[model samples]
Target: MSGLAEILHDNGFKVQGSDASENANVQRLKKKGIEIFYGHGKAYVDHAFRVVVSSAIPDDNPELVAAKELGLRIMHRSEILAEILKQHHGIAIAGTHGKTTTTSLAFTVLDYAQKGAGVINGGVLYSLGTNIKASSKPGGFMVAEADESDGSFTNIHPKIAVVTNMDAEHMEHYKNLDNLRQAYENFVMNTPADTGVVVCGIDHHEVAALAGRVSDRKVVTYGLLPEAHISADNIMQKGAAMGFDVLIEGKRYAGFRINMPGRHNVLNALAAIAVGIECGVDLETIKKGLMSFKGVGRRFIRIGDAYGAMVIDDYAHHPVEIESTIKGTKGGFANNKVVAVIQPHRFTRLNDLMDEFAACAMDADEVIVTPVYSAGEKPIPNVNREELAKRMRANRIQNVHVVKDPEEFNSLVQTLVTNGDIILCMGAGNINTWGQFIVQQSKLKS
Candidate 1:
């Protein structure tokens, strides 16, 4: 929503918003001179010409209610984003995970090649230091993250669409795994038929199956599997850099390097590579873009050093994302034990996917479970940290412990951690605040 605000403000629209509370993302917009209110009420949006909000906003929300009463031009976030996309040769990246990184990477490739690509990402882009960047030429080209949580991503019909992988996510809105998969299928199927192509990761069985469902649009596949049209080999981690050789239908292009970790990230890079190729960028320039790429914020980002251990943070709320993040952080070269600090985001999600969540953190030598970070959702019965820890214990995960609050979490990090341990904090909630708190506690604030 902030990305939309940024882009709209850049496009000469006066954008002001009201949030229930302030956070890093809101702070970024404030730095850009965008006005944001701390609390919400009808008076906030009373004078506004149009009020924009995501699907998560309740109907009873004060501003939304007032907007309807006033009969102002109210719009959904996806609608505004879709309207922005229609203004350019847009590329919409859709998936349960990796949307932010892939969107950032695709923009990097185009920006490096001087294609003047704009970006609307879920996370802060390290290269631009912001989530939204206007295209160098108006309506020239752009890339955006297509959200699927409320089945609203179908509102966008871009020239190019990329699906990193499809997983069971946002089940509260989706209700079931099949419905979620259908949404992803609709995302690609909704793209412009005459000129659209969906870049997909074929390694995921469901996403691969989704490709078959889209007959009118061209589907480009990339992954570790040989069957994929675009695949990579000789993947190695060099300190923090990952090097791999790209293969296009048995044709090899050697020495593709990205300054990020994990095979999952490699797949992300491949998706961006496919985007670059479709944009008419040469392989060498695409390689240069990948080499110069920094990374997205909060995806394995280092927040602090506590008790001689490096603390990494990521927005990995789902089981699949957590597994990928841990496996990526391991990176096959570190001797240090990986300790995953898992915070269940919502009670409903924890209640829904207890089995998958329990077994996802095993790659870590130790696991610290935190209290559920309810994003204003009501709690579910029997869906607490101790129960989750019990499930993890059933999986025989080593050293699983549950921490009730930030104080205990900080105590454990500073006192018990080994000299060379890697503490990876993963969640979609206030876990980032915990990372920041640890940094402040350790005087590691940079």
Candidate 2:
């Protein structure tokens, strides 16, 4: 939400916000003339401006309670963002995965294609050099990553909606995967009739159902397979990058290259292509847009090289995400041993999908599990990393260990990582801290 604050501040809206931690984002916001509070404070709430809170924050937040007690207007972050988009045509990228990259891609394409556009993303986009950007065009576009973690996508009504793919996730919030799918369907259906909805054909059935429901919106499908409206064909791998020809309507239109790791990224590129093509951008413009993307900070981003080892930090917290990320790494470095330092994301996710997590990490040559990042959730019995490591060992997976801190993780990597070894620090938590520590130490020793 730092991006939102920055954007508002730039637009002459007095912006003040609070965070639980004073991380890089907080620091950046402070530099951008935003008054940032490090902790919750009732004093932060005042009668001068509106208060915005994300879905992750509870209704019981002291600031929110104070705002309510003062009878001040309050808005969910998503709701306020939707209001901000009113002055510009909006494209909301929604999905369980790939939203960050795709949304970043869309904004980059618009900017590079010389069409003025604004952007908001969940992750720090290297292209914009910030999480948000302001544009100055009468036909300006607002491109945003529509998050569905707390069903926030429902609050956004974009002129264009891109559903990368819907996977069964955020089970704690949604009753089931079906409920999650239905929520996406409602999001699509709620769009204006003249708008377009681009659905990734990988999740053809789930997203196609949305197309069936939204008769007013134009629906287009894209994927790696030929069955979609836009398909990626003749895929070739070179290191951590993939080069493929994007086919539109069974005809190959143009060649595309994505330096980002993973087959899932091929799908993300296709989504960007679809959006660009619909917006009347040239094929070369789209290709350049994709090529210029250095990738968002944590989506398979290489932190730095540590000794002879290559360390990558990724925000893959789900089982499927873990498998995809590992597979992508293997595709890039075929002969290198994969050492994974995995910090299970949440207690509830660990308890719910323990077996799947084990299966995903089993692909690594060596796996080290760290204490779960609770994210404020209470721990469940027998659902810790030790139990996960034991299960992986019992499953005949070799070289699995449980670690408590970054020091232990660095020590494990020092022992296991050989020349040309690929070390992946995987999680949605502070696992990147360990990766960064290892890389920094390696740099210092060298």
Off by over 4 Å in 2: 444-446
Top candidate on lDDT is 1
Q: What CA RMSD would you report for each candidate? A: 1.8, 1.6
Which lDDT tens digits does candidate 2 get at residues 213-282? 6676688888765677888878877888999888877767656898887788888888888888777789
Candidate 1 segments exceeding 4 Å error: 444-446
Please give, for residues 206-306, the per-residue lDDT of candidate 1 as tens digits: 88998878887888999999999999999998655789999999999999999877888899999999999999999999999988888888887888787
The alpha-carbon deviation from the true structure for residue 110 of candidate 2, after best TM-score superposition, in angstroms, is 1.6
**Per-prediction TM-score, please?**
0.96, 0.96
Counting clashing residue pairs in each candidate, in order, gives 0, 0
Whole-model lDDT values for every prediction: 0.88, 0.82
TM-score of predicted model 1? Answer: 0.96
